[model samples]
Target: MKPASKSLWKKSVSGRVMVSILVSATLLGTTAACATKSGTDDAAVGVTDDVIRLGLLSDLTGPFKAPAEQQNLGIQLYWDQKNADGGACGRQVELVTRDHGYDPQRAIALAGELNDSVLAYQISVGSPTSMAIRAELEENEIMAIAMSWSPDLGESPSLVVPGTYFGAEMVDALDYLIEEGRVAAGDKVGHIYFQGDFGEPALEGLTYAGEQNDIAVEAVQIDPSITDLTAQVAELRKKGVSAIFLNAAPPQLASVAGLSEAQGLDVPIVASMGGYAPQLLDTNIAATLEERVLVVGSVTAYGADEPAAVAVRDLYAKSGSKVPPSQMVVLGYAISAVMDAAMEKACADSELSRDSLWKVFHGDFQIDTQGATVPLDYSTPGVSPSSQVIVLRPDKSVPGGLEVVEKDYAGPTVAKFLDR
Candidate 1:
């Protein structure tokens, strides 16, 4: 028999006590007039008259613990604001969180434990971890907002990703490099990436773009446990690479940048979204990042003057957080924003089932986060909502520590990749 869903509730509630208190208070006030019902009594797995529970499977004790925590903060902030304004269908939002430590096995186990207690998963971190649980999610008809950008997840109807996939991002990055004259048709480019599912799509994108542009691409793989990338950088440098595309973590990206500088290789460094972290600016490689790094992503940076951006800043300020929010916060906010829209639509339809939520997401709906991110459309399954990616350069002067270099850049390569 499947594990009891409530068994996981205690674990979920322990780590986020403060946020839970704030959420519970707001929920009581806002949902006071709504009739109470058991979560499993009527429509869906995790819905009731007074509450809608969502699950968050994160990497709180792993390599991505810090960013995952920031993401959780952003998700909490979004739901808090929504509950304050009167939650969806008169029900307050609640989160059931579990830490998987970026382990696929742990993620699978946690999914089994929480699958029956939540309406949907708001955030599931890591590519391989998400993939491990994808089958179970689909079997149960559970909707999830996946944090990974692996293109394979795009094919799963039960999953939705906020931004363009790594492959598409790499395609756009290569196209940008070519257009800017940093690389040419015959120039050799180096791609340094993680070895598994997380980096495969990016490698595919780079390879496709290279074939299209007649550029020679060389690849170097890195294990997730290896912290130092000096040898990889040296190998790429020896190959006479004109530019480097990084599909690794932020720290690894920093290591590559620092090692490259130490080796006197000064080519442009184009990084996938995984390489972006606001804290990277505070590191010793800040100057190197400013001079050479360009980050490509689908969401707007945190410091933009747009409505969504302003809202994020206001949310952080209101939360009384001592440190400033990061790009991961923006990412979490964006995911929650999209999920909120779907929930609202489902509630309005008088059916808050998983099927109803799925219909809402697949109904050609456009989510506008008021500049916090590029608008997303979920009309088509297995396809990215937006083809455009925003490119940002590190700038200490900006409040978010990065400034937009290009907005909505739709490179020919990404368009081609999307078409295929």
Candidate 2:
């Protein structure tokens, strides 16, 4: 195997050199490999010459607080590590964070605030929040990386960026179940969701995939205001569902899993990209939730068995935040990894402006390049609608970690079955 070159990148102020000779599409590319240990800064904006100003929006004080706070720990840790390393392209990257409380209006305000303060944005929670701030984000031309799995998120803006999204992820989960023979093509798959746009897309994807692959689909919807899903479970069981798909958060997911287990339903229960986590596992409904729940992910969980994941472990240890890493935390690291790559590429060329970073994001990314994880394939146009995903199963042996049972699986990703 070819060893990576020294980290001491050469710096210059001359015209940009197209470092194409060392390029490898499957590798980090010339940007990360040949980037000079140097960068530009808008001192007026408080951006230090050796610092890349970055921002993060999360639900630290809101309903999504548990997941978003976990992401904050990871994001802060990422910047800490980057600053320690002299940051991407020879400069340090400073990360700024905010709490949106899962409200779109507040998210818009937060986006504007970050726009005035930094170069880029990273999000850790909420569709409503994203929907609120998207316009302002585009107006500022800031590069955004997020953990939202919404399909519409893939739609690119002059400034907005879509992170890992949902529909395609469901395809990954469904495909895994199929390939593993956990369910057959002719079986009836159950869908249980709270009525909302967030849950609607998965249903759309499930129905679409079923039509293409030949499977039966059944759906059940429960009121989000309700405390339990015993009625929903009974309805699904009456339909004789051979497999189950969920598009709810932890509390709801736990409730459904508990009810299913209580009713002695043996069908495989799969969750959308952000369903089950350590929190959901140990809830009042923990017993049943631990038995048969799988979560599909648009990004790797923090406990990933990958190179970047190792970096995250180091961050987690240093932060002293005891919460187990979830899609939110892991995506925090992953987005940082992408930003590092983009900043390295842009700063090497002495173009560290928000617009410049946007260009780099469009050019330098290689998420799951070799299919190691879910590849963020920007080569295709829309992001959210096309993002791939992986399957995560709870594992007792990994202490505060999840075991990914499948990789780049596309069967569960389909949404047609849910539509039926």
CA lDDT, every prediction? 0.78, 0.61
- Give one digit per residue, the lDDT tens place, for model 2 in 1-420: 011122211111122233211112212222243254344444324255555567777787776777777767766676676566555655666777788777778878877777787877755366667767766766566667655656555453422333345555555566777777877777778888767666777776677666666877787776667658888788788888878998887667777787888898877888875566676555565555555778776556556666556556766777777777665666666556555655666656655676456555444244442222466544333444234566677765464457676665555434333233
The estimated TM-scores of all candidates read: 0.88, 0.83
Model 2: how far is 277 from its true place, Å?
2.2
Best by lDDT: 1
lDDT of 2: 0.61
Steric overlap count per candidate? 1, 35
TM-score of model number 1: 0.88
**Per-residue accuracy of model 1 over 41-150 as CA lDDT, tens digit each:** 46488887778899999999998887898889888888888888877667789999999998999999999999978999999998888989988987777889888777
Error of 1 at 83 (Å): 0.6
